[model samples]
Target: MRVFGMGSKAWLLNCAILFACPIAAQAAQDNGHGKNASHAAAGAHVHQISNHTTLASGAKVSHALHTASGKRVATRSFGISCVPYARQVSGIQVAGNAWQWWDNASGQYARGDRPETGSVLNFRANGHMHLGHVAVVTKVINSREVIVDHANWQSGGGVSHGVAVVDVSEANNWSAVRVELGREGTFGSVYPTYGFIYNRPDTGVVLASVSRPAPQPSINPVPSDLRPLAERPWRTMEEVAESPSTPRHTIDLGINAGVSR
Candidate 1:
């Protein structure tokens, strides 16, 4: 993985496009492309967890870019898109065990990187966890709290949205975060159909997220329910990756912990 400093020219461009376009519209145009599939595949093959570096209460996390051929890809810190998952680009399988962390092909999330406001949010599945496409981070409340809107986080296929405020006082454990259920749905109906968030690298460790139960799927689908509030035209990856406000950074994290070969 190639590490870099946060806040680069690319980051600025990313921010501009990310905020300018509507989330729903973007997803609609680029729903479930080869990129997401590649990341999902890479996530399926990674092994081991808990080896990445950490921060001291909101320390900036670093990021890197790796090519599909096990080559280091050039990236500007948080500016790189976690949207579609890393494996999607590398054609690698994301490694994970029953109820474990979804390790990207290059172990993307755990790497110390700067977090963005709307990047893809990740969670650990304690054990025997087998659900896919779970939730989205609707809002970020300071460095300690976040709001999650999910559809099928639970088994019943219920959809619900709630807020989770991270607990900084207690080892940054999400046990203190607040979770509230609002509605119900089946699978990714009310949740993410295919979206990414601008996430800060330290979000998972520093701000413990509160995990809540997803709502039960309704017998009948809600009409006009899943339509995203905003819609926009689709753009090429180059276009998408070249907007302002992308948050650039110099690659600097030390890659001591290697992914299982």
Candidate 2:
């Protein structure tokens, strides 16, 4: 796998990219900003969601990035959505919106009202979640409860890891569930689900497609006075803003988390 690069860089990002690209494409499709409209039109569903990450005050700095050219550019990249994250991570090999995952997995993957580790919990399309949502089950706490890791769930494209999900279905089925909104003890509204799509990671197309370049990032000039500092002739406003104690690295990125690692 050429995409398998070396070093601490591969620590978290190497594996994350294999699944992140498709996820970003799904986002590009929904936002109608990219070339996936016709392809996305193949289905009406697949819904959307986000996570929590309060960007720096006064500017959305969370997704901002500085290119290698030292141009001090700004790229507004929202983090990964749930669909591609669930698909590639769970190896479900299904495409479309998050809501359509259940039907998409009809003959391809095993699904049911029960939760299982590594399974994709497919949420139904409802008034609240128009495109629907999908999450990768991380741990099954019990027959009626589980922990899931998913992106774009709370706010800022932040991935919520080991979040508790309680089954709220009347029949004790996992047809409906409420996710932990933030800190423990605070849960959100009841969400209908089509159940869990269970399967092992398919190393076929989904994994192979890690070779695809990350989604194109939206570029903007980093606001600066264009005055180079005496000590550091290349210093930009953002570079100056970063903590002086923080190590510096020039990272040119397109949508996959902005930071290299």
Candidate 3:
């Protein structure tokens, strides 16, 4: 099995193609229908399309697709979770369970209680976070506070950007941290964490055990004008088509005329 790297543009392209193909196929079959029939079919198609969110590299991503009944369905995107996100940003490449990252890094990546840029902060599973969580350290504000970019923490449940993580541990260590949820400077739930995964000359870096295949480029490139689905709440197929960035094919997904992506 080939494991592809996360957060790359190639991955996004793959997602776009994955969503676009079925719509194209369905549109071909629906052609020649009358005006009212087309409208009904389109409405039915929108409902059939699945609207589910998935965790990729720890970031929440939506992979919406259409079904025959026009009822929306939700499916997980390519098994992407928090560990992959940490590996992608930190270049540590340690695999296995998210909670196991700390132990897995022994003799490979340096482990520490302090925060540093490019390090992976491993959160220990607690009552709230059952499987545990991992995030990348983007900036160190002071001894007590740091800024991080992580996936699956936002209320809408995608990627949370530039959030603050404050060390609330008693020993002044990073044993416990309160992460910023949505609002800037407002820390959310306090999660217990193992510590930070660092890459230093003394600690050494562990190469990934599994080799990931190069991502297959999408047959159609996402139009430059298209806005990322992650940026906003879920939108209907019609809304997506009406957006300025939506490709002609997306608009054609049972809507206007010919298909475009």
Question: Could you tell me which 10 consecutive residues in candidate 2 have the lowest summed lDDT?
Answer: 57-66
Q: Count the backbone clashes (under 3 Å) in each candidate.
A: 73, 12, 13
**Which consecutive 10 residues in model 1 have the weakest lDDT in total?**
183-192
lDDT per residue as tens, model 2, 150-250: 87786676555556666655455566666755432345656777777779432232211113222211222222321123322233446668747876777
At residue 71, candidate 2 shows an lDDT of 23
Q: Which ten residues in a row have the lowest lDDT in candidate 3?
A: 217-226
Residue 152, candidate 2: Cα error in Å is 0.9
Tens-digit lDDT track for model 1 on 169-188? 23232221222222211111
* Tens digits of lDDT, candidate 3, 216-238: 21111121212233422335344
- In Å, residue 47's CA in model 2 sits off its true spot by 26
Model 1 residue 193 lDDT score: 25
Q: How close is candidate 2 to the true structure, as a TM-score?
A: 0.47
TM-score of each: 0.28, 0.47, 0.46
